[model samples]
Target: MASPPCSAASNFDCGLEIKTRSVEQTLIPLVSQITTLINHKDRLKKTEKTLRAIQKVGQAVGVAVGRFVAVGEAIALENEELREEMGHACFEARRSGTAIAQLTDVCGVEQSAGVDRCTVFSDKMAMVKAARMLLSSVTKVLVLADRIVIKQITSSRSRVLVTLEQLERVSTFQEFVQIFSQFGNEMVEFAHLTGDRQNDLKDEKKRARMAAARAVLEKCTMMLLTASKTCLRHPDCESARINKDGVFQRMRLALEQVIEIVTDARPGAEPKALPISIYNGIQDFKARVEALRDCVYCVPCESLAVQLEALVEQTEDFTDSAYTSHEQRENVLQLCHATRQDTHNLVATFSQDQQSIKAREVSEAMELAILKTSHSVSELRRELHNVAVGRASELLKIHSDHAILQALKTAGEDGNLEKVADLARTLTEQREQLVETCRLLCHISGTEPLEITCIHAEETFHVIGPQIISAAQTFALHPNSKIARENLDVFCESWESQLGDMAVLLKEINDVFEGRRGDKRAYLSLPRPGKHSANLKTVKATKLDAEELSTIAKLGLELRLVTSDVDSELERWEDQNHDLARQCGSMARVVCSMALFTRGEGVLKTTLDLFHQAELLSEQGLQLCSLLQDFSTQLLDEERVLMVSEMEKLAVSCQQLQACAKTPVQGKSATFQKVDSCIQHTKGIMTVVASLLPLWHKLIRQCQSEHSSQASPQHWPDTQLSPPLKEDTLNGKGSNGFGVKSLEQHMASLTFLESK
Candidate 1:
């Protein structure tokens, strides 16, 4: 700074130049520096403009990039949501794009390049459409699954209620088992459908409900199975208690499971207890089961036991009576059947136990009692049947006796004395047989023989006694002279003989009936008698007491009146026979005298009278022959044949005598011959008649002997006359005046008598 001041005076001139030069140098540098500064300022202004533009461009690019990034993130998030919703449905929709590629082939697109390019845009479009369709389908599936779950839960609950009701109503072991088994099957099916996790359901609440329903069903099924097992093991009242307990436990478990499921479905919620109604229902069922068990143990057994004991006492008391009525017997049978039914019920109750020793013993005892009682009833029925049959037989015998007595009365009224005698003999034989039968029946049945004999005797007397007396009176009073008193005498003799025999037979039967033998047991144990032994013992032991003998004597006295009447009628018949014989002899004498006389008016009148008398005598002889013929027919012996022949000869002789009397004499010799023939024929007729009497008597005795040999009773009527004899009698053609066969011997006899 000092040098610049010195240069300012000497330096004014020198400093001026130095200043100028310094100015030049400084100006040049300033100018140069100014130019550089100007250029730097312009460049800095351009750089500032460029920086503003760059800033604006950077802000626009940043905004556009930010929008693109936001769109990409939104698209990615949408794709993730679609994947979660669609599942397999989206894949199925994408597979549909292959169809569009196939359609491009129809447009002439080649398989190499055009085919690959043709479906590119279409494939992307199809993928988006498929995604939307998959979402819709998934939404529908979730709705259907929720509905199914709700329905299944409701149905399961209803099924459980029905099963419980059925179980409560079950009466028998088989019924309980069947119901339990059905419930078990239903539970298994429900578990199979609900427990399956393969189905892709979206509703969380519905799935939880289905799970709870399945668990409850399973628990109920298990409880039912346990009850059935207990019943099978012990089929008694005690088993019912066990079954009820099991059901209660199952109900509790099922309720617990449902509560747990409900709590799980509702997050942050408490589990509630079962409803009051459901709890009350379970307790009610338990009480009902207990009541049924008590009734089974007490009611039926006690009532049945009391009834059976009463029936036993009644049956024992009934045995003391002498006779049991039909109503009483029927009541006993009903009691037995009721007792057996009660035993059967007891057996059914204890069937499951293998060691019911006391029950089996009681059943065996009841069976034995039933068998013994049945046998006793059967025996009583058999005895009653035998008695009924015997009574029927006695009635038949009485009818037969009445018929025979009627026949005897008819024959007597008709003046058929020989028929009357035959009927009397038949009646006697029948009575004897009846008495023998009564004796045999008494012996077999252990009845009173005297009682049976008395009944038979009473019947015989009532039926036959009056008939015999009436027949005898009718015969005696008959106006027919032809039925000579001699024939009646013979008939009375025959009746007397028959009646005597019947009386003897009845007495013998009574004696046998009264005789004492051994006890029934001893008699049955003895060996059976042979046929010969039986025949030999036909006369029974007669050890009757005084009273018995007196009774028999009284019965015998009843026949005495009949015998006395027969004798008196026989005496009257003998007188009548003598008168008839005298009248016949007078007629024969008159006929012989007429043959000796001339053929004048007076002689003719006498001959006519004699002829009328001969006719009367012939009619009487014919009546006698008819009676003898009846007796002969009854005899059925060789003597019967002889008697019949003789009677026919006598009838023929009578006819010859009438013919000779009726014929006119041609010469003196002829007239004498006729008279002699007439006399001889008459005598021949008388001889034949006399001969027939003895033959008739012999035949009657033969008939009686034949009837006595037969021991069995006559249960049916005898055969009527033979067909040939009936035909001959009805034809009205006379054979030797006998109304039967004509004999050549009779004609020869007539010729011989004429020749003599």
Candidate 2:
């Protein structure tokens, strides 16, 4: 019978049942999503909520799911205890029958059938066994019922696969109505019983529960999409409904995904080949150089300065030691490595230019273009001086002897021997003084003591001694004594030759210090032939593009800024002024924050814009990182997820309890206990989720205020704000009124399901 043509009363029954089922299935997920969205409508929503609630209630609002789990655990423990009790009773009953013979033997007494079969004994044993069996059966039934209920809760939402045409294609609303009732009944039945048998659920029930969960998740998603569309069309009612239904949860998850993408950053935009370690190394090197420079700059002397000139020369040679700063060295290495890798990748990935020049050729040429300003050669000169200075004292003594000998020879040639004695006395005294001075300075560079070699001392002494002797002789002899002066002339010539050789060596060293002899090309030119291959047109055809040129210029500028000696007071003054400007910027931010809170969000946004400009100017990467941390604290919170999960759990528990009420074992204590456990669990989770709301709300407030305080670019101060001081009292003990005793009591009362 095609049921009477849609009678009003019949239609009401049918429509109401079908719609009720559909709404139950759809609403849970919809609510979950809305809850999440509400959490993140702005970052501060949860934080503000948490703060206000904390201030009002003086209690920690924790996630509902945590409470739910705690309750579940308690129930599981109680059920296990029941099972053990039942097992023990069964064991006793079984032992009473089978082990009677053993007992008789042990007691040495005859057994009587009367004792075993008597009404009183048999009744007592039967009652105990029945009670145990009843408990076991009830526990199993309740567990199964709970599972069924959970499944239904997870699958309550309707998924209408039918299109408009398909719906119209239905033979009659009767068939549609019957199908809807069947599905709805199944969902409702499962929802009611699952609460009863939550713990002792079987494999099939577990699978069914999982399937239902998945289905519910899908349906929820669809409902959310529908609701969102509806909100877009006629937002007022839909928006309110969405909030009530908890559709905000899914929105928050979506937003989080987007945030992750934004924060990841692009690969190519990362800074060039300057390793962080290298930067630190350069800083250390800079410090060393600055200390050395300060030492030199403080010294004031003219004659002592002249005496200490060698030490100054050595210091100049060591100045290049700063170039060995880890940063500069690593930077050079990194540049080379990156260039090589790029070239290698290109060569391996693509065919080399056959018509054009080879990459190797270009690389060689590039290598030749790199400059090296090493001070190794000057360092070698200093080393050589240390090597020879020790012999200075011995040479001084030998030279004095040579002077006396020369004077004697001169006196003899002039026929004035008396003057030789006087010269010898003066020469000996001068030699002693020279020897002592040389001794003091001998080990100045910490080299080994230098002994005068017989060959060198003799050669010098012989040459100079004869010259002195000849001079003395010439003075004593007649002005016309040509034959007597011939020997003197020969000696003088020898002495001049020796002095000229010594002078030539000394001049060579002096000229090197004065920048006269070494090849300038060697200092400026590259060691390798192709280090600058990237710049060579003949080797690899590439024009100097703006980006490439800019990169090269930036690199050059950074190197110069770091490496150049900025020892002047003016440079220090500039640094101090820059610091003051930075401090002012921080103060400005605080002011802007106050403006944001008092004036309007627009003011805050203006302030932020100005802050960004100032931040860029300051080049304070660490400070920027700190700001990012603050921003992230405001933006990202996991409370939304916790809230959604809690709501779902609570809905499931309610459904399971209702399902259990309809089951055959409706009056079972185990079933009631299961329901109680689920309810407690749900309550716990709710508490936990609620706890985080205030923190989220506070964060959102901060974020909004920051945005409103943005400053104008033109009038923006060349400064930035310091980070806000943290409030230690905000989350202290009194801030949350859950004392130790209260928490322990709460924990003791709840049944929590331990996750596998």
Error of 1 at 19 (Å): 99
Best by lDDT: 1
TM-score of 2: 0.16
Off by over 4 Å in 1: 1-119, 122-126, 138-157, 169-174, 197-222, 227-756
lDDT of 1 by residue, 1-756 (tens): 011112112122211222122223322322232122112222233343544443343333334323433443343355554334333433332332233223222222223444354221234344234323422332232332233444554466457557767766666544554464455445444444344421222233333333333323332332343343333333453423443454545454443344344223443565442222211222332233233223443334334334444434434323332233466556555654654454444434534222465532334444443344334333432333233224325534455335665565466557776776677677666554444433323322222322333333333333333334333434434524222232233333323333332343344433333454334221011123331232222222122222222222211221222222222222222232433334444444443333322211123233335344445556656665565555556655666677777878877776777676666544323333453454455545654543343233334445555676564223212222223222122111223233111111111121100000
User: TM-scores of the models, in the given order?
Assistant: 0.18, 0.16
What lDDT score is found at residue 166 in candidate 2?
32
lDDT of 2 at 67: 36
In candidate 2, what are the lDDT values of residues 1-756, reduced to their tens digit?
112212232122222231122223322332232122222222243343543432222111112222333443444455563445434433432333222212212111124443444221223344233323322332333333243333333343222222211322333323322332333334333323232222223233232232223222222222232232222322234222332143334322322222222222234564232112211222332233233222332232122223223333433322233323354334434433443343333332222322245522333323222111012222333433433332343443355334555655556555665776577566545433333333222222221111111122233433244234434434344334332343233334334333322333333334443557554221121123333323312221112212222212222222111111111111112223433234333433332332222111223333223233223322332342233343343343664454344435434443443343233322223322332332233233223222322332343344455555664223122223323312111111123432212222222221111111
Model 2 regions lying over 4 Å from their true place: 1-213, 216-219, 222-226, 233-625, 628-756
